[model samples]
Target chain A: MKHIESESNASLKQWKKLHSRKEREKTGTFLLEGPHLIEEAIHSGAKLQHVIVEENYQMKDEWLKERFSLWSVPAKLMKQLSETEKPQGILAVCEMMDQPEDLIKPKGRYLLIDGVQDPGNLGTIIRTADSAGLDGVFLGEGTADLYNGKTVRSTQGSLFHLPVVKADLLQIIGQCKEQDIPVLSTSLQEAVDMRRASEVEGFALIVGNEGAGVQETLQKESTMNVKIPIFGQAESLNVSVATGILLYELQRNRS
Target chain B: MKHIESESNASLKQWKKLHSRKEREKTGTFLLEGPHLIEEAIHSGAKLQHVIVEENYQMKDEWLKERFSLWSVPAKLMKQLSETEKPQGILAVCEMMDQPEDLIKPKGRYLLIDGVQDPGNLGTIIRTADSAGLDGVFLGEGTADLYNGKTVRSTQGSLFHLPVVKADLLQIIGQCKEQDIPVLSTSLQEAVDMRRASEVEGFALIVGNEGAGVQETLQKESTMNVKIPIFGQAESLNVSVATGILLYELQRNRS
Candidate 1:
């Protein structure tokens, strides 16, 4: 373990650059903050390159001291590296797992996200997918960066528990079809009531943008488009909440 | 209709002060920004005391000029009175609905919230309750203020469509018992699986703090304690998502 007291340090500069999405993508790694997330990363065998902590923060796990490159920085430096208003004094740099095209299997439950622009919403949806025991999550183009700080925080460490891949929706949809997995798309018009949608063994549920229900091309490609019934005056449900309800319904009625 | 260019003007000052919870509570009114919310406010028959817009904004609704006290302020002043990153150039001063004690009926679906601290989560829960056609939403102490901007935005104007009351959860539970309405309290321990829970005609579901499940005293007072089964590795669901799932289950199984 070493102490990093200066922001001008070369290593500190590189760590600070991880805050940018371009830098994260280039390095194939992302920074996640807080003690719980770091612990989760360690437990999940995520490739954590470095574990950084504020100088005053106590090291709870003695094993972490020797597990990876440990660096202690001043509170000012920690705050600069953190995205939240209240920094938890610890963060880790973990390699983005290499996702192969075969991450999705023939018999699996999956979530296909298209154009969810909010990082918080994307993270919550990922977390919900994990909570529903979905086999994987495929993020289409225009979705928020999965490695964004807010997305990491909102995920509550569930990102480590599931397979989340960034891929093209059309190609992924084609793959699901080839594998005989029914893809259910959520839509606001000309769709079967979600409650009455037939149950399937292997499925891919597609949820879309906040304002636009789902892209027309994607809706056309889906095996069926389903809509949750609004029993009251609310025009719509929040995207994350709606996804949760749909996932729960899918799981609840699985034959 | 009047035009005001100065932030120090009396009405503009009062509108700016509505940004704070103390001022909003004291005045029994709240400020809502954006065009959609203003339209929702008008359509819901909510008491709109004042409508303020940027000087450059075009009035699409001529009736708004005659319906309320319309004030036009310069962009700089409108920005000062707005909460969003980009002010939509229109906002309204709405009187808070006076919620009567008798809002809860003998046979009606309802949601009881306790200690949900995040304004966004609280608002989304309320919106979900509205989507589920709950008759009312009773907020217990420690919950976020319903009039908070984030909470209001999260509701997406569902706040205007339903009766939302600030009340004591224990007292509300007592009333449910007296009226023979089933009270379903969510709990993490020693609770029946919600999937197996019987359907009901009219029910009140209680969801609690983000960290803590429903309060013990309130849980003890309930007809039954129910738990959503966790099918995955997630420790728990986001409070709002969990509330949405529970409400959906309640409505889906309504006999």
Candidate 2:
């Protein structure tokens, strides 16, 4: 273990920079806050560069002490590095996960995210897609950054469990077409009721921005546009909740 | 139209106090910000006490001018009373809704929320319940205040569409039993798979805290405990999304 008391320490300065999306992308690594997310990363065999903790914090898991080098920093410095209101006294620097070499396969279920600006919604959609056993997620232009602190926290560690890729949604849709995978886009207009959507062996479900449904171009490109029926006065469901219902309906009968 | 430039105007001072939950409860009134929500309130026939707009903002809906008194306040004052980052130059002071005189009816579907602390989750759950056409929602002790700014905004005007009551979960469960409505408590322990749970003519689905889940007491009191099976590495679903899935599944067969 090494002790770093100054805020200007080189490692501390670099770790603090991870708070910015640009910095995380440029460095090819992001910070994981708190013990639970760090433990999940470890369990998922994520590539971790270092584990940092407050100088007075005790490591509860003995294996963690033996497996990784620990950097002990002052409490104030730890707080400076944490994005949350309450610092958990621990953090981990982990490599950005690699997109699966084969982004989509025949007969595989997938989620195509389009311009979901809310970090919380984006993260929950990923977590729900994971729970639904989706093969992967494709982040279209304008979606929140996958490594955003709010998003990572919202995913509740599922970010480590599945493949999430940032790519041109149009290209993905084209590829799915080639593979005979149906692309179902959610839209408020010219759409079939989601209940009537036929389940297939595989699909690429596209859900979009908070106010807008799927972007017009994507809706036009998809095999079909589907919508959850609004049975009451609510204009629409929250995007994340709608995604959850769609994924559940898509997988329910298949299982 | 009444023009008030002073921040200390009695009405302006009173409206600002609505930002606090205590003030909202004490006065039995809450503020709705933005044009969309105000219009929704007007359309829903909610008790709108007054409409306030920034001095420079022009009222587009001519009927709004004829139907209610409008107070024009300074832009800075409007920002002070507004919860969102962008104020949209308008706000409305509305009376808190009255719970339905008859709380629960025979064979009516409902949602019981327990200890969901996040205002966003609570609001989204309420919106989902409305979208699912549930008869009403009972907010158990420990759930976020319905009138909190974030919650009101997250509901996206759905707050005006349905009946939401603050009540004791145990008592609500007892009422459901009397009405022959099965009270399904969502739980992780010794719970039947949610998919296998039979669809009913009416149900009272109780979802709980994000972390601790349905309190032990409520779970024990409910008619049955149900769990959404996780098919992947994620541990659980976001409470709001889980509520959406449960509601969608509960209503899908009946619709």
Best of the candidates, DockQ? 2
**Candidate 1: where is the Cα deviation over 4 Å?**
B253-255
CAPRI tier for the interface of model 2:
high
Docking class of 1: high
lDDT of 1 by residue, B1-255 (tens): 799977679888888899899999999999988877877777787888988889878878654555688888888988888888898898889999877667667888889998999999999998999898889999999999999999998999899889999998898888887788999999988898777774777898999999887889899889999987877778889999999988888777542
Assess the local accuracy of residue B28 in candidate 1 as a C-alpha lDDT between 0 and 100.
Answer: 98
Q: What are the candidates' individual DockQ scores?
A: 0.87, 0.88
Best TM-score among the predictions, by candidate number:
1
List candidate 2 segments past 4 Å from native: A63-68, B63-68
lDDT tens digits, residue span A54-155, model 1: 987887865465467888999999998888899998988899977656866887898999999999999999899998889899999999999999999899
lDDT of 2 by residue, B83-150 (tens): 88988898888888877766789999999999999999999998999899989999999999999989
lDDT of 2 at B36: 84
